[model samples]
Target: MIAPLRSKKIIVTRENAGGKIFSKKISQYGGIPIEVPLLRIDCDDRDENRRIMKQLDHFDWFIFTSANGVEYFFKLANKHQISHEILNAKNIAVVGEKTNQKLKKYGYSADFVPTVYDANTLSKEFLAKFQNPGEILLIRGNLSRDVLPSELKKANLSFTSLYVYKTTINFKSKNLLNEILQREFDFITFTSPSTIDAYFELSGYLVDKPCVCIGTTTENKAREKGFSTILTPKVFTVDAMIDIIIDYINKKEHI
Candidate 1:
C-alpha cells in the first residue's frame, strides 16, 4: 500500500531536539521532512533556578509544562549535584507526552497528565482531582501561558512559577529560506505559538498553505495570523499531529 504522506513535504518548525523527533515522524509516514527550526531552547536565570531548587522540598507538587522544562531542570540538578531525592516528597505532573517521556528519562514519571495538552485543560484536570489549596511549583519556559497559574490562583491555590528555559528565535538558514521561497510545501507544523511567531518573522509572511498545529493555542495563533486551512489534533501530541496529517492527506486524495 502507498504511504499516506507519500510525496508530501511537511515543514517542521520545532527547536533542534524537537524538530529532529518531528522530522523523523514525518519521514516515517513517507513525508519529506523539512527541518526549518524556528526556535532554540536555552537555560536561563541560573541563580533564580538554583534558589528554586534549594526550596524544591517545600512544595507539595512539582509541575513541568514542557520537555525543555524537564531537561533544564535536570541539568540544574546535575550541575548542583542535587540528589534525585529532592523531588521525592512532591507529587509530579507534566503537561504532555513529550514532557512525560522526558521525565521518564530521569527515572521519574508524572503523577498526573491532562487528556488535552494545554494549560487550561491541565488546570481543570488537576483542580478536579485535587481540590485543596497547597504550595505548587511550576517549572516552565519563558513563553509559557498564564492560563495554568491563573486558574490555580482563581481556585485559591498558591504556586511558584519558575522559568527553567527561555526560547529564542533560530536564525533561518539561507538554504531553508530559499526552500520556502522556491518549494511548495504540503504542510507546515507549529509545535507552539512561539514557533508560529518565529516562523512568520523569519519568512516575513504566512503563506496560504495548509498548517498543522500541536494544540489549541498554536492553532488559535495561526488563525489570528490569517491561516485558513489550519488543523489541530483532538489530542495535542506530535504523534497525534502526524495522525491528523495522514487523515487529512487521505481525505484529500479520496476527494
Candidate 2:
C-alpha cells in the first residue's frame, strides 16, 4: 500500500533543530521533507533576564508564551547560577502543551494551562481564575503578540515583560532559497508568525501551496500574509498537525 504522503514534498520552516524533527515526522509517512529553516531563536543577554530571575518570588505568576521562552529562561538562569528555589512559591502558566512540556523538562510543571493554546485564550482563562492579576512576569520571544500583555493592562493588572529570546531570519545560501522556491512542494508547515514572516521575506510571495499551521495564531498570521489555503489542527501540537496533514492527504488521494 502506498503511504499517505508518498510523492508529496513538504517544506519545514521551523528553526534548525525543530525543522529536523518536523522533517523526520514528514518522512515517516513517505513524504520528501525539505529543510528550509526560515528563522533562528537566540537567547537574550540583557541584564533584565537576570533581574527577573532574582525576583521570581515577587511575581505572583510566571507566564511562558512558547517553548523558546522556557528554554532560554532556564538557560540564562543556569548561566547566572540562580537557584530554582526562588520559583517555589510562584505560579507558572504556559500557553500550550509544548511549552508545558518544555517547562517539565526542567523539573517543573505549569500550574495553569488554558484549554485553548493561544495568548488570547490564555489571558481570558487566566483572568477568570485570578482576577487580581497582581505582579506577573511574562517570559516570551520578541515576536510574541501583545494580546496577553494588553489584556492585562486593560484590566489594570501589573506585569513585567521579560523578553528571553529573539527570532531572526535564517536566510543562508542563495542556492538554498532558490532550491526551495524551485521545488514543487505539496505543503509547508508554519509553527509561528515569525516563521511565516521570514518565509515571505525570503520568498517574496505567499505560499501557492497548501500550508499546515500549528495553531490558530499561526494560521491567522499566514492568512494576513495573503496565504489562501491554511490548515490548522484542533489540538495545537506538532503530532496533531501531522495527523491532520496525513488525513488531508488521504482524503485528497481518495477524491
Candidate 3:
C-alpha cells in the first residue's frame, strides 16, 4: 500500500535543527519535506541574564515553558559556571515532556508537569497544586506568552521572569521562503507563534494549503494570520503533528 504522505511536499517552518528532524519524519512517510526555517533562536548572554542566574537560589521554583527555554537556560548556566548543585537544589516545573527531557539533560527533572502541554493548562494546573508557592523563577524565551505569569499575578504569587533566549526572524530565509512557496506544497507546519509571524513577514502572504499547528496556541496564531484550513493535534508535539497530518491525508484520500 502507498504511504499516506506519498508524493506530498510539506513545508517545514520550524527552526534549523528542529526543521531537520521534522523533515526526517516526513521523509519516513514518503513525503518530501521542504525546510524553510523562518525563525532563528539565540541564547541571551547579556550581563542581566548572568545576574539573574546568580540569583537562582533565591527562587523556590523554576518553571520552563519550552524545550528552547531549558536548552538556553542550561547553556547560559554552564557558560557562567553555575554549579549543577545550585540548580538541583530548586524545584523544577516544565510545560511539556520535551521540556522535561531537555531539563533532564542538565541532570535535573521536573517536579511538576501538567497533563496537557499547553501554557494555559500548565498555568491552570500548576496553580491548583501550589496555591501559596513562594518566589518562583520563570525561564523562558523572549517571545514567550504572558499566560503563566499573568495567572501567577492574578493568584498573587511572586515570580521573576528570566529570558534565557530570543527568537527572531531569519532574514536569510526570505528568498528561500519565496522560492519554496512558488512550488506546489501539500501542507505547512507551524510549531510556534514566532514561526507564524516570521512566515507572514517573510512571505508577505499566507498560503492556502492545509496548515498543521502543533497546538492551540500556534493554531490560534495561524488563524489570526488568515490561514483558512488549520489542523492541530491533541498532543502538542512534532511527532503528534506528523501523525495528524498523515491521518488527515488518509481521510482526504478516502473522500
Candidate 4:
C-alpha cells in the first residue's frame, strides 16, 4: 500500500482567514497539517467600505473580484442593514465561478462572469460585453496587481472602488520558516504567487523536495527556488492541486 499523503507531513502555506480551512484539508488528507498564517488582514478604510456600499444604489453594475471581497462586503452591508433590494437591482459581474458560487450562497447570481478565471480574463470579458462605458462599482481587497480596472478605465468606464479588506505580510512566523528549512514534509502545496512570495521570504532560498503549485507563476517561483520536480495542474485551485498530487502518487506506485 503506497500512501502519498497518508501520514506524511504536508506543508500548507495558506494564510489569512483561509488558513484554518487550509489546515483542515491537509489533516483530512491523512497528513500532519501545520497552521501557519503567513498573512494578516486589516481594514484600513473602514468607513470607506460603508460609503461604497451606501453608493451601491448609484452604479449601473457591480463587480466582485474575489470570494473574500464578497464575504466582507456582505458582512459590512448586513452591519448597516443594507437591503437585499439594493443588492438585487444592479447588473452584477464576478471574476470566477467560485466568486459566482459565493454570490449565489448569498442569494445573488452573477449576470456576467468570464469563461476563464483571473482578472485578465474577467477584464477582457467585461470589455467585450460593454462598449458604451457606464459607471461600475468594483469591490475588491487591498492589493489587485492585475490591470483589470486600468483596462476598464482605458475603455472610458468610470468605476467606484470599495476597499473592504487589506492584506499584510507576516515576517515573524518562525515555525513556518523552520518547517521548510527542516524539510518536514513529503510534499508542499502552493496556490498563488503571494503564497510563494510569503514562503520564500521566510525560507530564504532553501529547496530540496517535491512541490506542487497550482499555476505557471507559482511553478516559476518553485523553479527559481531550485525545486526540480514541480507539479502543476490545469486549473489553479486546491482541488486541482490535490488531483495532480494523487496522479503523481499513482504513477509512482505503478512504477
On TM-score, the candidate that comes out on top is 3
Residue 24 alpha-carbon offset, candidate 4, angstroms: 3.0
Off by over 4 Å in 2: none
Writing each residue's lDDT as its tens digit, candidate 1 over 1-255 gives 788788698888888888898899888888899887789888876688889888887899998998889999888788878798777777999888878999999888899999887788889999999997479999998999999888988998889988888988888553585577577888889999998888777777768779899989999999999999998999988999999999998898799
lDDT by candidate, in order shown = 0.86, 0.86, 0.91, 0.75
The reply for model 1, stretches above 4 Å from the true place, is 172-175
Model 3 spans > 4 angstroms off: none
Sorted on lDDT, best first, the list reads: 3, 1, 2, 4
The global Cα lDDT (0 to 1) of model 2 is: 0.86
In candidate 3, what are the lDDT values of residues 31-70, reduced to their tens digit?
9999999999999898888888888889999999999898
The 10-residue segment with the lowest total lDDT in model 3: 83-92
Per-residue C-alpha lDDT of model 2 across residues 1-255, encoded as one tens digit per residue: 998777688888899888888888888878898888888888897887777777777888899999889999888888889787667777899998999998888889999999999898999999999998579999998888999989998889999999989888987833586677787778889988888888877877665888999998899889898888888999988888888888888788789
Q: What is the C-alpha RMSD of each candidate to the true structure, in Å?
A: 1.5, 1.5, 1.1, 2.6
What's each prediction's TM-score? 0.95, 0.94, 0.97, 0.86
- Give the per-residue lDDT of model 4 (tens digit) for 1-255: 634456766677767567676667656665576666666666545876777777777898888988877887787777788886787778989988878888999999999988777787889888987886478888888775556778987888888888777766677775656656575567777766677777767766656667888677678878876779899987766667777877887788789
The local lDDT score (0 to 100) that residue 235 gets in candidate 2 is 91
Error at 184, model 1, angstroms: 2.0
Location of the lowest summed lDDT over 10 successive residues in candidate 1 = 172-181
Q: Please tell me which model should have the higher TM-score, number 3 or number 4.
A: 3
